[model samples]
Structure formats: structure tokens, C-alpha cells
Target: MLVRTGGPLAAVDPSEFTRTMARVPTPVTVVTTVDAAGRPWGFTASSFSSLSMDPPLVLVCPAKTASCHPAFVAADRFLVNVLSATQSDIAGRFARSGQDKFGDGDMVPSEEGLPGLAGAVARIACTLREVLDGGDHSILVGHVTSASVSGLDPLVYHDRRFTRPEPTPSLTTAG
Candidate 1:
């Protein structure tokens, strides 16, 4: 049975919308960039995706209030470090507001000259392409210049919790 009773669909409640979106799984990554003074800045982001292949483009969303937002917006290059399932602590450290996120000293200079986490599942170095307004966050598009990936599972976020994806079973045939 179906019923139609409204001229337009009602707007979704913000909290309910958030709750619904939380069920969708996303990869956790740390977006890093160096400031003009040569200081490293970074933040954890679950909103990242590949947009193009011919141009090798990717995008990440950083909130306006993020501590490293200004630096990332002004920088010419940045690195997206795809976290491994074992790196939840690193993700938590970068997610905080006013703390020494890099104080633990597990970073090395990436090929792009930005700080990269030591044990990431993958690293993508990119040059800034564009910045677009995205309400409370900014959409940053980058042209990937260099990238590397390790044979490891990535960290994931779903329902406001950290989780790891299960590997699919391989097909085998008995001779």
C-alpha cells in the first residue's frame, strides 16, 4: 500500500540525518599539509574519495573550524594518509581540537615534502586543484602527483565507531 499526502517532502531532522549517515562506512584518513613557516598540520577526515582517473583527482572535506583548515587551504600541496586498522590512536590524536597532534614523532617527510604517518596503508601526495564552499566544511580537490599503497586493510568508520573490513574469500577449485 502507498499513500501520497504532501505537496513536498518534509525536510529531514539534522540529528536523524546524522544518525542515518553514520551507518554508512567510510575510510579514515589523515590529511596533512605544511605551513609557510615549515610546521606540519593535519586532521583526521572520513570524507575523502577519488573523483577522477585521467587527471588523477581526489577530494577531501575539512570543517571550517578545523585547526589545519587555513594551512591546507593556503598550501600548494598536501598528503592524504590512508590509515591502517592499527592506527586508530593516530586518528584520535589528530581529531582533537588543541593538542600536539604530532608530538609522538612518528612522521617522516613525504615525497611532496609534507609530513606523512609512518605506517599508513597508502599515501597520496597531491597538488591543490580547487577549493569550493561546502556549507560548514570546504571541499578541497587535489591532483594526485604521487601515490603508494601497501597490502594492508584500511581503517574504517561506521556508526561513530572504528572498524576493519573483512577480506573477501578467494575462490578455489580442487583438481
Candidate 2:
């Protein structure tokens, strides 16, 4: 229950906040970047969205505690790969900490050398633009350099699980 005493709203419990957030379906993405030594780093992220169109920008939040966070924070560019529902296993691998994330996946390197998933439904190559504070996570803003879509249904996360997005049939006009 939330009670407003005429001042500020009561602080919501973190667990409750998490539960409430789970109700919103979000696309599953694997954001990848490399270290100074050229070692690849990646992680599964559901906290992602397009932020702008004119200048082309996107945002993704990676927890500060993520093992690959440092690599991303240091890299000047990264790739955002929206996975197809069939890649749930790949998403699971990236979501885990201290595991080999790219070993079995269809990892491919772009012309500019950024690592990305081969069969991603959508891939956005971005130049790291800005970083903002987001409490436990860091909000990374990227300037889109190039983007491509595979015309496939994307995987999504909801209620703490990954599921295929069922496409709704488009209606025809009664012409």
C-alpha cells in the first residue's frame, strides 16, 4: 500500500518495485564491447530503448556490478543486438556472471571490429556517447552509427522470464 502524507510519496520497497517492473514486457538484448586488450565482453540487457531519432541515439542500463561493466565503461563503442526468441539460451548465458558468453553463440565481428551476434533480429552499432548515473546501474547513451534489422520476431522478457513475442495479426481495411 502507498500512502501520501501530503508531502513526498512514500518510498516503494525495492522488491515491490521489481515486481511492478516485471509487468512491463521488454526486449532482450546482448550489448557487446571489447577491452583495451581486445578481449570481448558482453551482457544481456532488458533495460534498453531508443532515445532519439534525429541524431540517432539509444540507451541501455547495465548494473555497475556486472563483470563486463568496466569494459563497456572504457570502450568508445559497442554493439546492441536484439535477439530472436530462439536465442533465449544465448541470453541466459550472457546474463550469468563469470561465464563464457560468446564461446558457443554465433559471435561475429563487424567491419570496425565490434563484436555482435550474427543472427540478431536487430543490430545497432553505436559510438559511446555519454554515461549517466542510475543508482545501481549506469545509463549508457550511445550515438547510433549504423543499424540493421533481420525482420524476425524478437525475444522479450516479462515476469522474470524470456518468451517469444507473439505477433498480433494486422487488420485489413474494408476497401
TM per candidate comes to 0.91, 0.91
Please give the lDDT score for candidate 1. Answer: 0.94
How many steric overlaps are in each model, in order? 0, 0
Query: Candidate 2: what lDDT?
Result: 0.91
Q: Per-residue lDDT tens digits of candidate 2, residues 18-84?
A: 9999999999999999889989999999999999998999999999999888988888999999999
How displaced is residue 155 in candidate 1, in Å? Answer: 0.5
The runs of at least 3 residues in candidate 1 whose Cα sits more than 4 Å from the true structure, single-residue gaps closed, are: 1-10, 171-175
Q: Rate the local accuracy (lDDT) of all candidates.
A: 0.94, 0.91
